[model samples]
Target: MRITRVLGATALLFALAVPPAVADSAPSPSASGDDAAPTTAGTSFRTAAEVEQGQQATASASTGDYLYWSFPADAGQRPTVRATVKLPDAHAAQSWQIDVYDGLRRRQACQYGAQTRTAAQGAASVDLSCTLRTVRSWSEPWANDPLPGTYYVRLTALNVATADLGQPISASVRVGSKDVGGSAAVDGSLAEPLVPGIAVTSKSGEDDGDAAKSAVLAGLEPEDGWASGWWSDRWVWTAVGGVLAALAGVGGYALTRGSGRPGRVPPGA
Candidate 1:
């Protein structure tokens, strides 16, 4: 009876202890608040506004238009970006492409997955998800390190017909970050969020002087070494908390079982 009671007590304690730890450590679901409205045309990186991680944003564009968005990241963090695009039913099929670029406007390799539907099938839409692995920004001078800074995501329509030139398409974007357990310290800071001369210039080299000035005034530069330190990763701490809680539960169960052994019965008294 004593052994049974001890085991029951231990099980109860473990059940009670584990839940709180898991709840505290697990990543919270991203809020389903009102969609964020995209500000600039987002055709270029310079005009792109910062997107808060895990928040959804909405934008409107035509076929062939390149929509851009910027996200801040740390060196050791892996980020996943997703986009859902809604198109007009007038077209039978369409192709879309999304790309990720680093601070220097260099393209970063990513894994891409997509789902497409035609108007006849129901709604014309495409869902895209891209993931980039952890990057070490300062590892080498010539390497295109996925450094911590403002990263750009550009979305383009590939097969728009001439008749669909002015048709409006809507897009929703979301970004999520996960820590891959790397060094806490970052190497340096970005001098400016807008990539120098790249922001205001069109592919044909046409310049928007006013847009350039406004970008400078926006003061969007993140603090130097902003990605540094272990505390940045909340998930890491949550995982650690869960592990400790499990260990404690096991230890408590063992100790209780040892102590609740009925005192050895005093030699069969």
Candidate 2:
């Protein structure tokens, strides 16, 4: 069927007026009041400080130390990471970088923004940002789609002069997200997010970071108007496509169906 870009887009905007149903809405630990203040950065993923969306965090450390911070992301939300580094003055040109990893440690591709930047020699500060694609409820194993879960942001220096090895520097980070509503949501959803479990040592001292899973998996609930009755953005596109196809079919039939009926089979045959 023939369709125009304008019509397709119009249908989409109209369809997006409605949202999708949320399977769960309980807040994640990172979103709770327990972490009312910004948490400190961890040296690694295991110790990474947790922060809420839009909350800012500051850290002081050596030029070569790796700073890690984590935040939660729900389906239909696109999260972005912005970081600023206070480079030590009098330092040689160096490359500073920020990377985001998912629960399975898969590196997420930056959709836009300066994920890495090289500070000119003697530069006082360097700023970098990375915006990731919208999170999906579930994805195929072959696809590297972003999923709802805890995401980590790791910032470090790619190269630095030896003289700057122990130089102290200050850094600040902020993680935020914007809900796309149901525009990007899929038909299916996960029962809960992929929150990794922390290993707690036992009183008997038998296990220590070896193995055990206890963290409860939780899904985000849709907003007030997005109950089960609402529809996803995909449905709008499907409905529009179907309408266009039907119109095309009718037009084709009308054009081909001649005004003159088949000359009545020669009266006698």
lDDT of each: 0.62, 0.72
TM-score of 2: 0.65
Provide the lDDT at 93 for model 1. Answer: 56
Backbone clashes in model 2, listed as residue pairs:
24-220, 24-221, 25-221
Candidate 1 local Cα displacement, residue 184, angstroms: 9.9
TM-score of 1: 0.59
* CA deviation > 4 Å runs, candidate 2: 1-35, 198-269
Model 1 has how many clashing residue pairs? 0
Q: Looking at model 2, which ten-residue stretch has the lowest summed lDDT?
A: 213-222
TM-scores, all models, native as reference: 0.59, 0.65
Best candidate (score: lDDT): 2
- Scored by lDDT, model 2 comes in at 0.72
